[model samples]
Target: MTLTQDAAAAEAAAHPRRESVYRPGHPVDIRRTVGMLRRGPGDPTMVFDGAVIWRTVRTSRGAATLALRAVGDEIRASAWGAGADEALETVPALCGAHDDPSGFDPSHHPLIAEVARRSPGIRLARTNEVFDALACAILEQKVTGLEAFRAWRLLVTKFGHRAPGPTPRPMYAAPTASEWHRIPSWDWHRAGVQPPQSKTIVRTAARADSLARAFRAATTGDDRDRVLTSLPGIGVWTSAETRLRALGDPDAVSVGDYHLAHEVGHALTGHRTDDDGMLELLAPWAGHRQRVIRLIFASGVSEPRRGPRLTPADHRRH
Candidate 1:
């Protein structure tokens, strides 16, 4: 490479582009909002340090490292890499600027009312990167979170591009859709991902571009779910998860989650309930079901454990 090109690259690396958004009256907790996107505590794509949050994202232009910190009334954001500009442009939405709670009446339930009162800064975060959200959502399908997080860590650390800026630790953005589709079967197996989950990712990766466009253009949560579930292996739960993270759809409910129904029911009714019952309980909130769910989770309410936690099945042993 030419010396001029090398010097320019070095200069860019030394100084990241910066932008800040003022939230005069909006009280948004940047961490609580964006924390949902994190798969697990050891997630390679995101990290938290006190009031600051750092993450790596794959944008249409390229990969970027984004750092966000919330001061009194504004959120300070900075980005580095080829996609820095695009990443900076999404700062508002990523910090929950577009997540309106106008129609949500948390008073419908006393518990929800109390929780919402205590946590007024909570807002749904939107990444606006559908493929990344979809890929991770597919990994989490029908598996224990430990298993899903392990597979995600293994695959991303191995295949993703190295983040360009100075980060709290070594971080990497998710692999591009084409790269995800090319992951060999053996690699997936070694990562402890069963064939079914891996195959779904492959199929989804093949149509990532068109899928992103369709999801963005979808006018309603149901419409987005239809487009996502129409694809082979994508289902209602996965579609809901994708919408929650990518589109910040507050109405999205992960109906088929293993523990969610029970947790919500236990928290609200003091007894376990099935998915149908959970839906019925949350129905009163209608357009703000997901917001209500978030409040419940944040409230740290859960059903009493009757037995030891279920162990994750290790497919690699087979």
Candidate 2:
């Protein structure tokens, strides 16, 4: 059998015959989208075996597992569970089928152009899971990646359900919105989640339905931004992070991120810069700010590390 045919058979057996294939017009690296789905190394919802990436997610129907792999120029997706159809349907957008870089002239900026030239396969990924992405962003508020990921692992492991279908390892699906709101304060504390962050998630989940509706109705970038930021505790940074991952929005720039400005500054100019400075530098690339930033990161340009690293606070101790 051809690789494509083999993959189709593997998928059919796994998901009651629900399978799909997608080929990008340009080169697309599967791992580039990994960061969008993965929370941390210990994330129980996602697993990356040597060959394929297996992920479990909760849909309106039920829990489902999706196995995704890149075969030559095509991406093969298979899934199982009551939500298998919904899960498989999302494969294309998740694999960059919706990415449009039209009118984005890389030649205008030498640094960005060079990065794009070197790695022509980079494509932004979108999840379209609003509540899950919002909840994850909330946990990441005012914390180091390690701290947030640790908290996320604890939260999901304790409250989430076992993954569906055959997987490389035991996996879990993130709890539903109600489950998040129902978690006791002690459990949140035990998970090292601060009160503010935990409360924000609970409140966000409380209006999850309305938020989903608003997102569905929103047609413009401004509409989406307003809907996301209207909720308490969500700001420019958090909203941008959510939009970039959930919607694959090219214009969402994480302006307040800790290191983004400095990295962009050093890559575009010769020195580090503040948020205002970075915004000034990126003004020309208004609609593609995040794309430009990703390119800068892909270029491996970073500001020199000086001063002590951020200490991971033990909220449980407090």
Candidate 3:
């Protein structure tokens, strides 16, 4: 490397870590915001210390790790690594600081109203990390949570970098899109990522930079969702899932989710419902549909499991 570039990098690295503080208008639940980022118990990119939540994210500039905590009105954050500034800037969004729920006047439904009352701090978080959101959603496509999370843990542990922070636990950043594209087929097979999902990841990675242009061009959350859906293998469920995290579109609903419809149906109408029924049921909530879904999850009522669970097809055992 040129001496000038080397000096620049050293200077950048020498820059002290940044800290940010924000005051949301309403109560902000740190745990719920962390839950939005967590994939499973063993997610290598996310860790919860007793007081603070640490997250390692792969940003456009580079990888970054942030220690985040919220108490009362103030949200506190400190970040490290190349993308530290970017991460610190986005901390408020990650904590749902910009989420406005005043317009979501609840219907007269007893359960929805009650759940809303019970959970004042529940807000949908937006990370604005599109590639990571899309990749994770693709990982979760058509699989049990166990299978998807295992695959995610395996891939990230193997290919991702150690988080750059003084985190209490070892955390890793999700791999860059280019790194994901370079992973061999055998590695994916070993990670329990089947062909369909793996192919989608590779294709998306190839066009990941181009997809960012669409996001930049989008003026509304709906437009951003459509831009994501334009990619092959990115359907309604995946797009909704990605937007819920990447854009925090309150209206985004995972329409084709295997269990979401049933749970929503049971909660709303006292019976199980399909995708169409769930959409119809959620129509009234329009702009705040995902917020309503979050409330339902907060309500602690889900449809009873009746069918056989999806068994993991461990290709490594083949």
Give the TM-score comparing model 2 with the true structure, all chains together.
Answer: 0.91
Error of 3 at 251 (Å): 0.4
**Candidate 2 regions with alpha-carbon error over 4 angstroms:** 1-17
Runs in model 1 lying further than 4 Å from the true structure: 1-17, 22-24
Q: What is the model-wide C-alpha lDDT for candidate 2?
A: 0.83
Best by TM-score: 1
Write model 3 residue lDDT over 178-197, tens digit each, in one string.
99999999999988888899
lDDT by residue for model 2 (23-106), tens:
776788777664457998888888888778888868888778889998999888888877888888788788777888887778
TM-score of each: 0.94, 0.91, 0.90
- Looking at model 2, the pairs that clash are none
lDDT of 1 by residue, 1-318 (tens): 699668647957665675656462778877789877898988899999778788897887777888898888888888888888778888888878789899999999999999999998899998888988998999999889999998999999999987777678889999999999999999999999989889999998999999999999999999999999999899999999999999899999998999999999999999999999999999999999999999999888888898988899889989
**Count of clashing residue pairs in every prediction:** 0, 0, 0
> Which consecutive 10 residues in model 3 have the weakest lDDT in total?
7-16
Q: lDDT score, residue 315, model 1? A: 91
State in Å the error of residue 233, model 1.
Answer: 1.0
Candidates sorted by TM-score, best first: 1, 2, 3
Scanning candidate 1 in windows of ten residues, the lowest lDDT window is 15-24
**TM-score of decoy 1:** 0.94
